[model samples]
Target: MGEPNKIKLGISIGDINGIGCEVALKTFLDNRMLDFCTPIFYASNKTISEQKKRLGLEISFQGIPSAEKAHPGKINVCNVWKENPRIQFGEATEEGGKFAIKSLRAAVNALKKNEIDVLVTAPINKNNIQAEDFKFPGHTDFLAKELGGDSLMFMVSDDLRVGLLTDHVAVKNVANEITTKRVKDKVFTMMNSLKVDFGIRKPKIALLGINPHSGDNGTIGEEDEKIMKPAIASMFDDGHQVYGPYSADSFFGSGNHKNFDAVIAAYHDQGLIPFKTLAFGKGVNFTAGLSKVRTSPDHGTAYEIAGKGMADASSFTEAVFLALKVFKNREEYAELSKNPLKKHQLKKKTKAQ
Candidate 1:
């Protein structure tokens, strides 16, 4: 079982055929990582042993029957399966998808039951992992259903946060997906997350335009004027520090993103392109506005360098640090929320005559 004080962190091993296991082992190889939390990997003992040998990593972990037997001050592997998995390094196979789901399901179940305080997921291939039981687009959608709440695809690197209006939707369907309700919900989710997760008092948000020059007054497109503008305006009138239908082309390049607490992009690539370019090898994909704390590395499964020992573990390591930091922040925030401080209006001093 987990120690009374050490936070139990459940790790979901994603895509056995890729670099998930490699990066995970690299992250935990440093003994300093165990000081923050008790790490529990939802994979079998044989699998971990194989990965260690393949990668030539010098580390040892205890094999536990389940998360209930996880111990602090030691790396724990919850052997979800008794048999050894067929690990084809650098290849995507159906077996890879199946066992990935096994690890994910076990970790998620532990997260749901409060057996784990936080969850740090490795990357998974979206194509092969599609099954009838898990028909969602990605982790955000699946976690939203299991954890219950509006999950925002929040990419975080220090103070730079970029949120998505629509995630995993086709380019042709992006415009139709941006409804007033969707905008409002996303804005609220982002706003609330800034306060609760990141500890911002009043969040200043920038909204990215859907078209060139923010529609150029309807010359290029009508989305900015017709849909995005009105929604941002309405939210601003509601006393939220929401601004723009700004041209996304110049926003990040001109360093305008650093001016706000967060930026809301119209779609997945719109936010991710700049975010990954700026924060690559260091960014963390954090799911905001969820009931539970879940985070993953910004990068995906590197099939090309799966077992070649060429994968970098910095992003995965950052994900671990972030999950633990957010867990403590949430606990403190919840306590403060119970008896929040009253908002007081300060009187303006009269000018001396």
Candidate 2:
């Protein structure tokens, strides 16, 4: 029952005991949000009610059996599970993890069936969300396996966009994971995402080095010169406007990130530390290089502020908006690519041949 041409957004409530429901409810409280998309939350009515009562919120949700029952201008809750798990705010319990996986799996299955146009997920407890059925590092890894694509963890905000070459890996293993093929794949993914998701025709990407001062010209480390520089050179030869192996320490400190359209960091903390530092409450984590659109807030489940009503919903709201924008942009770009002249008027030739 969504409005004509409106996208159907599927939301996966993460870590019931955390601030997932709080931020989600806050983000959807503004009635105007329904104008762009119909949100179908993958959670039970009991869960929503518990969150509302705990947060002292007044927003109401229309309980539905499935995504198809979602109505326009109304927040819909799809009961993925009937069992009402105990809500332990500011605590990570096994029950919380179990319900989080249930919600996420339900939403993901719905997405594969084309029941939702885009997905906006809340935060999850990575450690507790592990079980026999669900065993992955985080959302990106799970989505990569489910959706069958080389997923890139792309953090996006108004000021900067960053993609990770080695995501959710330990620092000791980062260098080994940054192979030539991985670098090329990540950069190519970033390039395509920039074009299709953000509507950038030709994006200039910067690469951050794993070592200090980009290995200080091989005096500090050889990876920057041997691995990173060669990979960048290959990309440039293939007509990509990519540069770097730039020093991570001075890159953000000197504001060199402003020079590029996007950045590719060698590891997670290398990129996220700066991204969160700058756009902590307003960044969106986009899963690039996937067939389906999926995004999440650039933060985790703030257990400490779960029931305190102090969790900021800015990142979650931005994630919703970014997902919608990316979905629309991809659709428009696909149509335009198919019919190059669809939006341009052909000039009449005036020649005496």
Best by lDDT: 2
Task: Provide the RMSD of all predictions against the true structure, rounded to 1 decimal.
Answer: 3.7, 3.6
On TM-score, the candidate that comes out on top is 2
Off by over 4 Å in 1: 1-3, 341-353
User: Per-residue lDDT for 1-353 in model 2, tens only?
Assistant: 34755799999999998899889999988888988899999989998998899899999889999988788888999989898899999899999999999999999999999988899999999999999988898999999988987899999999899999998999999889888898999999999999889977678999999898889999997998899999999989988899998889989889999999999999999999999998899899999999999999988999878899999999999999999999999988888778857634311221211
Worst 10 residues of 1 by lDDT: 344-353
- Compute each candidate's TM-score over C-alphas: 0.95, 0.96
| Candidate 1, lDDT over the whole model | 0.89
- Residue runs of model 2 more than 4 Å from their true location after superposition: 1-4, 343-353
TM-score of 1: 0.95
lDDT at residue 245 of model 1 (Cα atoms):
89
lDDT of 1 by residue, 98-215 (tens): 8888899999999999989899998888888899888877788889999999989999998689999999999999999998888889999999998878867679999999987899
Q: What's the distance in Å from true for residue 50, model 1? A: 0.6
